[model samples]
Target chain A: MTELVKVKNLHKSFGTLDVLKGINLTVEAGETVVLLGSSGSGKSTLLRCINFMETPTEGRVYLNGEAVGDDVNGKMRYKEADLCKLRSRIGMVFQHFNLFPHMSVLQNVMEGQITVLGRRQEEAKDKSMAQLQRVGLAEKASEYPSRLSGGQKQRVAIARALAMDPEVMLFDEVTSALDPELVGEVLKTMRQLAEEGMTMICVTHELGFAYHVANRVLFLNQGEIHEEGQPQALLKTPKTQRMREFLDGHALFKLPE
Target chain B: MEWNFAPVLGSMDILLLGLLNTLKVTGLALLFGVPLGLGLALSRLSQMRILSMVAAFIIEFFRTTPPLVQLFWFFFAFPILFGVNMTPFTTAIVTFSIQSSAFFAEIFRSGIQSIDKGQWEGSKAIGMTRNQTLRRVILPQAVKRMIPAFMERSIELLKTTTLVSTIAYTDLMYQANDIAQRTFRPLEVYTVIAVIYFLLIFVFSQLSIVVERRLAKSGEGTVH
Candidate 1:
């Protein structure tokens, strides 16, 4: 598989606090990589850096082998227009689902398609409806997000990203905000996407999902990846004491057989 | 003292004309002010330091100063300072439009800022340019929450328009003053004009309440 996303020694700092330091990763097309870490381990920041949502203080990100920002005097500088274009091809769903409140689900899904992709309205609507149907939310097309349950809003958010026809999808703890019962429906939709061969990078605490869906899992510690391997081996037999201690904390849920 | 309203009744046409003038100024000021306020709000929220500072200065200057003083400055001082002719009507429109816009800009800024940062991140994640996201997502949501505040500012602008009478503008207050002196019925004329102002303002307040309720029913201004 071709490397679709590559992070080269990426570093991000908010003032003096380093969120991500000396991180390197490579995600090939159709690979589902789950990021697992304790809070403040830089999992979400690493995902954000992929889309330039959080500009890296240093280093580079490559999509399909094309560097995202311009290399200027040994430092990366991004033009707004260039970053916008780059972001359009990389889909991301946030924890809050951030659907536009003024728009219906169908309109929310169609917005990026029409505005960013410059598709005709009719064509965009058709594409958006298909995505909604894919997420089993076709009936909710006309409903406002405020009227939907948490799971339904998340599904609509997923459809919104999918309608963009992105090369890769990044999910930043998309299920974290949902009520316990509502998480299954969102996970089911994500699993379906993985089975359909969409390249994905996910930052999640759902180890069951990692075991079931992720081809590989990366365990982060203090702004760096401390361990990486296939889910079955890495999760069950973590090589380091830090990974074991983290897993012990989440021992409540049984990993899927 | 015996009540006498016959003189006030005789000058109904003039009072009506003055009311019309008041409305004309209020309407024109809103038409100019709302858009100007939006411009100023956007500039103040802009990333450029110089642009935001300039916008903040304009908003602060007009908001801190008294509206009456602003009207007097435009009507009496502007023509001399600029060496141009200034009509009372023009002066009222210019002063009130900018003055009301300063207040409107604050309302708009707060409305826009009140939107969740997740909304911006969501829009950005979809690859929308900042302008596209603002025009499509942020402003639409922000404008809904701003309805009540906008109406309040508009009512304040309407009442402030009375200051134009001091410059010899033929507004309701000025006409009331004229009718009062001519007929020696200050009590009756002033009372009638006060009631007229109250009724007009009451209608606006009720209209805004209705709009706010309708917006609530439609599930707007509730999303974070």
Candidate 2:
């Protein structure tokens, strides 16, 4: 399989605190890689670094083999203009589902297409409608985001990202903030996208969704990939004490008797 | 002595003209000031050090100094510096616009900055550049938050137009002074002008409340 995303020796630090330390990763095209870690293990930071949302203090990122951020004097320097273009190819959905409160749900989905992609208004509307339909939110297009539940808002956010026609999607704890009952709808939408072969990197603690949808599970511990493998093997028989302990803490990680 | 508003009644035409001029100056100042302040606030919040510094200097200079002093300087000192004379009316517009802009800029900066950082991050995640994020997502919300502050500043600007009287610009207060001098009755003249100012300001304040309610009921910039 062709490698769609490659990170070499990624290191991110905020001030003196090291967040992601000397990491290397690769994801093939159409792969769904679920990053699992407890809080502050830097799963979110790693996901953010992939898109230059939080620029790595030291690293090289290759998206579809094209270098993201500039290689200047052996250091990465991203000009805002270049970053903006690069970001368009990689969609990200936030935990908060930060839809533009001033816009209707349809406008929220259409904004990026018209503004960044430079599509015509009519074409953008059509594409946005299709995306909204995919997420089962087409009927709510005219409603404001504030009028929707957390699940519906997240669906709209997903639709907004999908309308950009990005090559890869990064889901940052997409359903972590949702109510338990509302989580299933968002996960179902994500499952549909996965089935359609959309490349995805998800940072999430929902073992059920990860178990069902993830092609690979990457367990991060203390800013490093402590263990990683296919969902059935690695989760069923954790190779390391850290993984075992982590699984013990999250009872959902228990294998069937 | 006896009190009478007979002189104010006689000079109704001049007072009306002056009131019109006051409205003109206030309206023009608001039209120019609100946009200028938005620009200044953006500059102040910008990452570029030079833009932030320049905006800081301008905002502090205009905000700290008195509007009356600014009017006097624009009227008296500007001609000497530029080798061109300005009418008192022109001077009043320039001074108040600049001064009101400084105040409005503060309001706008706070309003924009107060927006949740997640909103900005959300726009960025959708691949919007900073300018697009601000224009489409941030400013539309910020502008709503700024309206009340804007209305307050406008009312202050309305009262401030009276200062133009010092330059003989013949605003409401200026015409009041003229009528007072003509009839030599300061008590009645000042009383009439005070009543007029109160009524005008009271009406505007009530109107602003109605506007605020409308904006709240129908979300700002929420179409369809």
Candidate 3:
């Protein structure tokens, strides 16, 4: 597979504190790479920077073999009209799902296709209904996100992003906010998406899902790459002392690889 | 230009004609005014500081001045200041609309800004432009959020109808004053006019509540 994204020495800070400092990583087409880190290690920021939702204080972000920006919101330099076109191949699903509360599940999913792609209302609705069916929520299309369970909302969110026909999906702790009982449903949907060969970068603490779904596991610590390898080796034989410390502290959960 | 309430009300034909004229001015003013107010509200939220400042200044200027004073300024002073004379009807509509727009703009601006920053980022990530989000996502949500305030503002605008009398416009209050002066029944005639104003505004308030309930029932996640 070809490399789809590359980050070099990315640094970001809010006020006096640094979140991501001198970080580097690469993602290839159709690859599901999970970033495993405790909170505040800048894993979420790294995901956000890739999508231009958060500007890196200093660094380069390359998507599809072109440097998108050095420091701008990174999204601003692209043709405003074509901005969503780029993101169509790369979707981001938040921890909360972030589905618009005022819209129905169908409208929430249909928004990008209709508003950004300029699909006709009927055409978008048809496509949205199909996407909902794929996620097994066709019956709930008319319902609001507030009425759905956490797993259902995340599934709806996954379908919403899928309606745009994106090749890569970013999951920022997609199941983090879910109840433990609800976690399995969202993970199951994600496992299904991964099996279909969609390139994804997920920031998650759920190492078991990461071990099963990810092609390569990246461990980030203090805004830098601590180590990375096939999931089993990273879990059983961490090469660095920092990776060891991370693994030692995380062993209690045995929840992450 | 003269304050002659005498014989104006006794001639029912003339009073009725004046009342008709009043509706024409008020109705047309509101028809276009509401949209303009929405536009002004959008301008107030523009990222450009100078644009927002100018919009804010315009709203504040109109909101602070007394409506009667603003009416005189638009009607009598504006023409000489700018070397143009406008009809009183034109002036009344212009002034009333301007007044209404300012309040509506501020009310709208506050409601729109209340949404979480996360919503904008979320919309942008999915590839919707600012305008698309506003129309498809933001404004629909904001409109429901603003229904109660909208009713309050409507009542204010209805009360403001009396200000047209200052410019010698023959609205309901103007007709009341005419009847009061003629029959020497200032208390009775004015009291009757107040009752009519109360009835009209009360009906409007009840209508908004019905609309609000319908909105809430439809899974809009709004109370007002």
Instruction: Give the number of the best model, judged by DockQ.
Output: 1
Q: Which is superior by DockQ, 1 or 2? A: 1
After superposition, the stretches of candidate 1 with alpha carbons farther than 4 Å from their true spots are: B217-224
Q: Summarize candidate 3's per-residue lDDT along B192-213 as a digit string, tens digits.
A: 6677677777888899888778
Tens digits of lDDT, candidate 2, B79-197: 99999879998898899889999998999888888788999898888789999999888988988877877887899999999999999998999999999989998899889889999
Q: Write the per-residue lDDT of candidate 1 for residues A1-257, one digit (tens) a residue.
A: 89999999999999999999999999999999999999999999999999999999999999999988888888778999999998999999999999998899999999999889999999999999999999999999999999999999999999999999999999999999999999999999999999999999999999999998999999999999999999999998999999999999997967656
Model 2: DockQ score: 0.77
Q: Which candidate should be chosen as best, given lDDT against the real structure?
A: 1
TM-scores for all candidates? Answer: 0.98, 0.96, 0.89
Estimate how well candidate 3 is docked, as a DockQ score. Answer: 0.55
**Ten-residue region with minimum lDDT total, candidate 2 chain B:** B215-224
Show the colliding residue pairs in model 3.
Answer: A207-A256, A207-A257
Candidate scoring better on lDDT of 2 and 3: 2
Runs of candidate 2 exceeding 4 Å displacement: A252-254, B216-224
What would you estimate as the lDDT of candidate 3? 0.81
Tell me the TM-score of model 2.
0.96
* DockQ, all candidates in order: 0.88, 0.77, 0.55
What is the docking quality class of candidate 3? medium
Better of 2 and 3 by TM-score: 2
